[model samples]
Target: MLNHFVRVTGLSQSAQMGALPASYAATSPNAQGGKYYGPDGVGNGALGGYPKLIDPHHNKVVADKSQWAKLWEISEKMTGVKFDI
Candidate 1:
């Protein structure tokens, strides 16, 4: 997931590390006009790994519906648990 994020965002690991403090600061209560932190921020830090895994821009899990179906098929075979997805 981290690799995917870095590739799509074109940010080096060090650059990502450098941005962490600012990300935390911006999500602070005072920085956000006293509202609680939310998932609407601009950078990936807003929602952490969730954005890395599920965000449309970063998601490379499957290219299209056929691949998605194939993934579920493999998973079901491995786990012996059918999924509705």
Candidate 2:
């Protein structure tokens, strides 16, 4: 499963917050932490780590309530063949 993480940068005076440019890691995201912990491959907190997961994908869908148009207008000023999603 693809995990999402944002790169954070800043300093704070808190145990929760370590040194500046803290490696606030957010990995091997277990959406259902504790409630459900998957399998691990080897050593604790190791890279190439596990908890094997099968990414679930939803059907490609377009919402109806959205105001944005289906096709993306690449650029109003640019002249080129624009691709649509």
Candidate 3:
């Protein structure tokens, strides 16, 4: 599932942005960490820290849409990739 997403997303990105700068594409992706929140919907409000996420409501940070949106904003600025979704 994860691999599929990466593949599809990569294809979509390529389709939209055309060929990526080889130098930039060759570097490690910036997926290390980002601002995150717990399942209880509380966070430090600062960006760039992956959450330990102990809240019972959510098993992982992926369930947090707000955080994802902010992360998406950061991603757009850094990668210059845009999507209609």
Ranking the candidates on TM-score from highest down gives 1, 3, 2
As a TM-score, model 3 comes out at 0.28
Per-residue lDDT over 1-85 for candidate 2, one digit per residue giving the tens place of the 0 to 100 score: 1222212321112333322112212344434433323223243212222344322222234333242343445352256665555
For residues 4-83, write the lDDT of model 1, one tens digit per residue: 99778855435465455456556544453332232333464543321112233353553467777787789899999986
- Scored by lDDT, the top model is 1
Candidate 2: residue 66 Cα off by (Å)? 47
TM-score of 2: 0.15
Q: Which scores better on TM-score, 1 or 2?
A: 1
Estimated TM-score per prediction? 0.30, 0.15, 0.28
TM-score of 1: 0.30
- What is the total number of backbone clashes in candidate 1? 0
- Candidate 3, position 55, lDDT: 29
lDDT of each: 0.51, 0.31, 0.44
